[model samples]
Target: MTTRELPMTVPSEGLPARVRIHEVGPRDGLQNEKGTVPTAVKAEFVRRLAAAGLTTIEATSFVHPEWVPQLADAEQLFPLVAGLPVALPVLVPNERGLDRALSLGASRIAVFASATESFAKANLNRTVDEALAMFEPVVARARAAGAHVRGYLSMCFGDPWEGPVPVPQVVRVCKALTDMGCDELSLGDTIGVATPGHVGALLTALAGAGVPAPVIGVHFHDTYGQALANTYAALQHGVTTVDASAGGLGGCPYARSATGNLATEDLVWMLRGLGIDSGVDLGRLTATSVWMAGQLGRPSPSRTVRALSQQQEQ
Candidate 1:
């Protein structure tokens, strides 16, 4: 491997030996695009991601077209890449969405929730409890169909409208999701306002609430440039699953202040540097992001992608 494509291995103590990167570029990343990406390109994107060694790729959301127009082609897109040898998880907003995903043979489904009432109202147009109520049956039905269900709790640290969320508040929602039969819970720093201390505290609280570290994943945004630090904190807490978008391609549509997610390339680099296995080829992944950036008609925002691509060009 070229020097630019690999990081020196220096394993960190008290961290997991391997991490499972939940690649969300196709779903969470593209959901906020102003213009629609062609379904063929999106399919190619998923294929490229799988080829890059992302085992759990979130394929698309079955949300109503009115909410996420970019992924309105979910039905058209899911089948094209369903044959890949990787787990393809799709977002299902309700029972209707779950039915749509199930009809397409999606074996893994996710439901999006919020930790704060303000974001719940803004994103789902319901209170937090009401949104959880809506998801209860969705989770139940998905579990019944033998589909792995992931519950995404967004705005876990800070909310744009209601600043500085309490740790206990986030824990309650997590408990609710776990009780409702979610196979896993991804705590989202939707607005990117989380610090390392906050990440540690929340994970600690979740553990206290009987939410084991193995079932918890961290999704951090880089709005405050704290995504990596927060992820390390979660890693210290034995969080093996980390959510990232390839090329840093996502922001929350509901929360305008939220920034792009933690980039997959960057996360892989850190995992490599810390001597932790992510099973992702950095060279292929960077090239994939560069290609996707060309498709998006822009440069990749991932610091590692930019650095590696620049070195390759030189």
Candidate 2:
């Protein structure tokens, strides 16, 4: 199929001319899958993502195999793509995870924190403050070795148990993570219940608190079909980094009602249409997602990938 061309001009006044896409399909997307994926296939997925023009592809997680057995091969996975030019950020849940990552020569790592007490206890088996305290030393140790640290704040907008999360609560957690030495923060809508209005309000609150927009990233799930709209809200507010999953392959394992993440192809399709340069090739990205869907024994959840794949078939 002929790939759609994107415009080079600034198409919208409210959007960033260029955005950085943080690809999390390999780790966050695949971690919850019931079927096990081979280490070699995981490495190839990362490679395919980079070749599709994603600069930062989260390669794997260093959590205990007992918790997330899908990424149990992090030790073997990191070695395959360590030499890649693009940034490979791996999720390290604790000091033990960090140790595993660093020993494999990883220099970029992510830690997760939750905004709501219910989610914190449910997901991490700790309170929100406890999770932050746990990550403090991990972030410190990683920084001591010159590793870049990204902090993820889950359930920032809505929580299944707590209902709507207060913006102040989210702000407090964000500040704590920043104070803990995270180079960047990725705010997650774990339940995908956020709309553009909620996003604008939270971003404004954060900006007022002096957390600059450039250092903030947004991770929205598409459960309610608002991920792309909410992403536009973030971009309009000056957020450069947006987290997406190739083939839309992730959900909160703890939140069973939650859906897959905002698809990378879906996001890229909008970015391209808005004349936002994300440095991604739409056709190549859709192809990668389609191939990955085959690996997972299902069609991709991304509308863009599904549509484009059909176009190719015709």
Candidate 3:
């Protein structure tokens, strides 16, 4: 059998000319893996990603060790790469988590919220309103402390327990975050079930409801293989920031059957083809993901990674 290669081309119009990729592989990606990735290897992962020209790298999460054992070394791990050239944003779930992050001089932090009540209960053990109340001071403190606060709203498209989510429900959460002074918000398709139409409708609704469209980012999983298509719709709707995992790593543990986030390499291919600048080197990015996959004892889940690796071998 032979594989036929088609030239990847970008749609000539109706997309943003430049896209900013927020690399989540180091934190969101590695945290979900079954194996315990050594601190040294994790440090190297961030270093390589930064070297590959990613301007924003989500360094690590400051969640409780009991909840997310994989990232228990957040305190120890963060110091190792404190002053990387790119922006390093860590996840802080509460006041204590924020304290831990700020103690280490973290200038940027993210707080995760859920658009669906079901997910909010499953993931945070709190009702939607309860969770938002908890994070209210967290976001305020981060902003007042001179830290850049990034908000993440998960289960934005659909929920496992609950069917398709309403766009206004998502917009309300986003409005809350933006009102709380979040510098940016990343809307996550937690189950990877969102189609392009869904994405467009949501973005359009968000804009109509007075949410700043440019400050919103899309975080998508590939469970249904619509991550890239949904992302294209987001771009068409004027979203510039995108959250992607290196080599297509990480997913919501609470969202049943959720897969990895959109791959940085795949997003880069589309951006580069459209003559859009992402500041990422495709060859170097592919090499970095392939190397990280080797460290994890598995092949990369990214289509772009597999295709580029084979092309390089040939």
Instruction: List lDDT for all candidates, in order.
Output: 0.95, 0.91, 0.89
Which scores higher on lDDT, 1 or 3?
1
Model 2 agreement with the true structure over 122-176: per-residue lDDT tens digits: 9899999999999999999999999999999999999999999999999999999
Model 3, 1-314: lDDT tens digits are: 12233234555687777888999999989989887899999999999999999999999999999888899999989999997888999999999999999999999999999998888998899988899999999999999999999999998989999989988888899898898889999999888999999999998888888886788999999998999899888888899999999999898667658989899999998887677788898888888999999999999999988997887678
Q: What is the TM-score of each candidate against the true structure?
A: 0.99, 0.97, 0.96
- Candidate 1, 46-83: lDDT as tens digits: 99999999999999999999999999999999999999
Ranking by TM-score: 1, 2, 3
Q: Which ranges in model 3 have alpha carbons more than 4 Å from their true place?
A: 1-11
As for candidate 1, its clashing pairs are none
Pitting candidate 1 against candidate 3, the one with the higher TM-score is: 1
TM-score of 3: 0.96
